[model samples]
Target: MPVNMAEDGNVAPGLSAPIGGKKIFFVRHGKTEWNNQLRYQGATDIPLNAEGRLQARRAALRFSLAKVDAVISSPLSRAYETAEEIASFHKGAAVEKTSLLTEVDFGEWEGRTVAEIRENYAEIFEAWRVNQLNVDAPGGEKADDLYERCGELSKLLLARPERSIVVVGHGAMLRALFPRLLALPRVSYFWRTRIDNCSITAFGADAGRFVLLFQNDTTHLKVAEGRIASLPLL
Candidate 1:
């Protein structure tokens, strides 16, 4: 809420010392071999594909027009590649990689699509969807783990003292973080907030307060360049 000074007649919240005014330029890594297979490529080091590279380029163009103070990303091949693409344009902006933003560790389900997982882990598969409980991914991180880590990343971004920052992260991790940021219910899955590859998400922040701006935007994607004919909508 904006407060107006009676005499000045100007709306001003009396700006406090700004935090990492860092705008997180969240991004989804490009396509991987597993992506083509429709598999869950979490915690796995999968590189981007040709189309994914192009998508990264398009995403960079979007950032080129924004105020990017720093670039931080997940320590995965795909995420790093996408960050590198953006750095190509902002030559001086360094890309920092951290494991905190990694996708959910899919454990036994890694590299396999849902169809395949259902064959053996049938009950677990069914349970996994509604398994929003504090459950584990068989051999992976629990629902709470991803949220905790991403939350840490969020706070770090807010404290950076920089005006804005960009974070390149995975979809599942992004899924986990969004709800927490919006004060939504904490669950493994929350209404399936899907984002496209090489997309950008923004959160408005000041002194650690967050307001969602736009999400899962892929207007930068070109029909001729992306693997998917059209960006998926959620």
Candidate 2:
């Protein structure tokens, strides 16, 4: 289904689309303290901050009237909490956790700031920052490994019976996996895509191909307080 926002900037009721297939809405988890600090939170299991909780609630309201058959999320607390908020609106939809959706393991980089990475792991950080290389963190998950994991998740979701699903996850993992889900090119390219906290992105499978109905639409976040969510250094 194609989600629309009304003239008043509220999520409009009656989301419908001409091209129909299984629908997947990918939602990034709400703001965590690490998010604001621009720290790498890979595999850290950080919870939602106060503002994040409110954002999750607003995101919940966005789906209050929609038909979500299933809600899937990363096992990480941030993602699971966000999924829980969204699933609350759909009485029948229970939050399902999967390590397949977890953020890229930053390894030694976890909990470090971008500035720290630049200084400590200067060469690799520069390479990743400049070319989006498929490099691995010191003792952590590599970009290529994360891509394959995402492929597995894609297969799992497509094989399921649910027609509509909501997946709450981290930005880096979603960036790596979504391109594969859409059958796009190198996952590195999509690592540049900005997935704002609690933003709602949508797509549908049509004729065995995924159609991008919308990307990173944060209109629902208007209901929450005004604060820009900066990207966390993954």
Candidate 3:
């Protein structure tokens, strides 16, 4: 089972003093070319584009003053690049990559646009759009699979000794992880949540449970670029 998170208010930089618990900040990797093209990039190791690099820089600046003990990222280039940007600020913070943080495998649905998927696999696509839990991406993992991964990740995170950890990951995986951490209904929340690229979501660990500090925060992007309208809504 995944660790549950308690809902809370306005988030500050890192945890408040890092008293005795752990704080984990989740950052969605910057946009990729496929992201701009509205294509599914599940498990694809796409690199960040020019705009994405800039976004990553901005995200890094967002935590410049915070105390980051460690930075964990998906092995995918997009996420690793973003993690690099953030890790640059915290001089000694080690940036570690793990396959467990990789994006959900879209299988046959990978590298295709929603329209293309709908046109080709109409019934399955529509059913998935209506209720994601009812169907799986052709040959890909199901919600349970992703949820189990999230649970394993939670256990790993909780066991870590680091006080503040930054996790850079992909859209589908992060979306799946959030609901699982919050102990919410996965199917409903998964589709509804909008985890924009480079957005910052944070949580604090206490008493074997996590607390939601804030979620889907894009203040860094707005302040740095003032181009929130152009950002990808992954």
Candidate 4:
């Protein structure tokens, strides 16, 4: 059963029992140059850097042993490339793009560094940091807008015939959506919730509700890093 939207646009547990066991792996895309520079890349189509590629490869290796049924991604190149890496391990799996999965629109702040935003738009930035749900990015989107899209995405994933699905997307959007899916307070959404590049968060359907299995699991990357470090030098 798919989660339904409440009158307040929050996620509500479905009334009907789920037909079959279903799981969702929410994967954030690997790092990009913008990510390394701490730039606001909302809606900016930045490609992955060398380190990002390695991160994606490590993430791929992690999922290679899992029963991944489908790969869904944001249209952004960084996310799509990461999804491609995951799809490589799952033969016959196709990567599907969804606009709903795209990163939050940064508006005038896109491509700007946090420092720059703080220097130029301190009031707006501070307001957003304090209460993101109520504040809109200067000419960009508010938290509620992102929640609506994520709500749509939740429904789409629930409707899928596949039992196990991998959704690759951006950090901001994922962070924004996480609270809604868990029915947590919107104010508590981003605080202390780490959604690292190529990190995997998992959820499982139980009794017509989505239960969070884990959040920001990147142990596989640590193993991969150890393996790389252990390689003999030529």
Count clashing residue pairs per candidate. Answer: 7, 0, 0, 1
Candidate 2 local lDDT, 71-186, one digit each (tens)? 99999999899999889878889999989998888899999999999889999887776544377788788767777898899888778788888989988887777788778777
**On residues 84-173, what C-alpha lDDT tens digit does candidate 3 reach at each position?**
999998989979998889998988999999889989989987777666644688988786787788889988887889988999998888
lDDT over C-alpha atoms for residue 229 of model 2: 29
Candidate 1, residue 42: the lDDT equals 88
Candidates sorted by lDDT, best first:
3, 4, 2, 1
Off by over 4 Å in 3: 1-20, 225-234
Question: In candidate 1, how many Å is residue 142 off?
Answer: 1.9
Off by over 4 Å in 4: 1-20, 225-234
Estimate the lDDT of model 1. 0.73
Q: Name the lDDT value of residue 201 in candidate 3.
A: 89
Candidate 1 local lDDT, residue 206: 59
lDDT tens per residue, model 1, 50-158: 8888778777776665556788889998999999888766766899888788888989999888788888788877777774436667888877676678678767766
* Residues forming the 10-long window of minimal summed lDDT in candidate 2: 225-234
Give Cα distance to truth, residue 100, candidate 4, Å: 0.7
